[model samples]
Target: MSDLAALYSEIEQKTSTFCTTYSIACAQGCGTCCEHFMPDITASEARLVGAYLLFIKKDFSLIEKVRQSIGNQEGPCPLYRFDSPFHCSVYPARPLICRLFGACAYQGKNGFAVFRRCKYNEEKTMPEHIDFHSEVPVMQDYSYLLRSLDDQEGEVGFLPEKVASMLDQLQFLAVMLDMDDTNPDDTPNPMAS
Candidate 1:
């Protein structure tokens, strides 16, 4: 779990740098992407989000939402909060796809990095397109690294189902750890490794 967190941190730093260098940014307070998209994420990503929600945010209702959204492939993502400036409920533990989308370049067929402006960027804060010959953070690179860290129990699936499954596993572990004596809810997290 710590390894996954480290990977996420590394991804965040790389994507942020890439976005900054390219002046790519989401329009402020706009969650247009989340509104129409559901991320397909790995087991490790789900574990981190589930742990963050179960232990950190302590939001059971959101967990229920995750469960309810199972089998929903076309969706406004379950974590999306329409009213929040940070629309994602689990921003800190958002999946790799979420971290990379619109913020980093994709590996082009020519074996170089390419970036295009997000259609939802109505503010035109980001560039229309970029062709890069130099090294840049590519989605495919981060994806391979992320998959290497996953335990692959749930494998990769839509955000709702994967997260719900991981949340259940985490909750069962919490109960088995003895809720009355050593409260994992408040203790230093085991990170659900």
Candidate 2:
């Protein structure tokens, strides 16, 4: 749990730095990105989310909610729970992918610019005073930082089912083990495995 808390703190700092650099005003009670689906969580993140749910004893409710939500759709997301005022219940332990969202992007060698916008800002146009193209930093750079977080083989992609069951529990243990293996540096590593 301490490792998970530290991980949240680390990412929170990164996200705060990002918002500061771009002058983005994203805060709790802001609930802008909470309404949509987060499609790119790593296995480690999924596990943390699951642990949060289980720790809160919302596991069965989360599972049932996810099941109901994915009737025709797909759901590898066990932390895809509901909350009031448009927020995720398991937000604290949500994946790094979710943290890296909003400003994250991907570019092709052919110079195709791809933007990943949060659902919160999708239809709601930016205020008339803002210049989104020039003012905000692209999400691509943040993604590079996230890529360095994992010790997996290949690019990390979202696979909720792979992490939806017992596997998620394992990731929680992995995060704890990681903390145990590290020396007490200012910046703690969340997982050893």
| Tens digit of per-residue lDDT, candidate 2, span 30-149 | 554444443565555555665555445445555555434433224334454344554556666666656656643345355554444445664433221233343233356545555556
The 10-residue segment with the lowest total lDDT in model 2: 126-135
Model 1: per-residue Cα lDDT at residue 125: 89
lDDT (0-100) at residue 94 of candidate 1?
90
Model 2 bad stretches (over 4 Å): 1-8, 26-34, 67-83, 103-138, 141-159, 167-193
Q: What local lDDT score does residue 76 receive in model 2, on the 0 to 100 scale?
A: 34
lDDT of 2 at 54: 49
Report lDDT (CA) for all predictions: 0.84, 0.49
Q: Compute the lDDT for candidate 1.
A: 0.84
TM-score of 1: 0.89
lDDT of 1 by residue, 1-193 (tens): 8888898888888888888887888887888999889999998888888888888888877888888999889889989998879888988889889888889988989888899998888899899999999989988988888787777553688988888888778877786674422243455445544
User: What TM-score, over all chains together, does every model reach?
Assistant: 0.89, 0.54
Each candidate: RMSD: 4.9, 9.6
TM-score of 2: 0.54
Number of the predicted model whose TM-score against the real structure is largest: 1
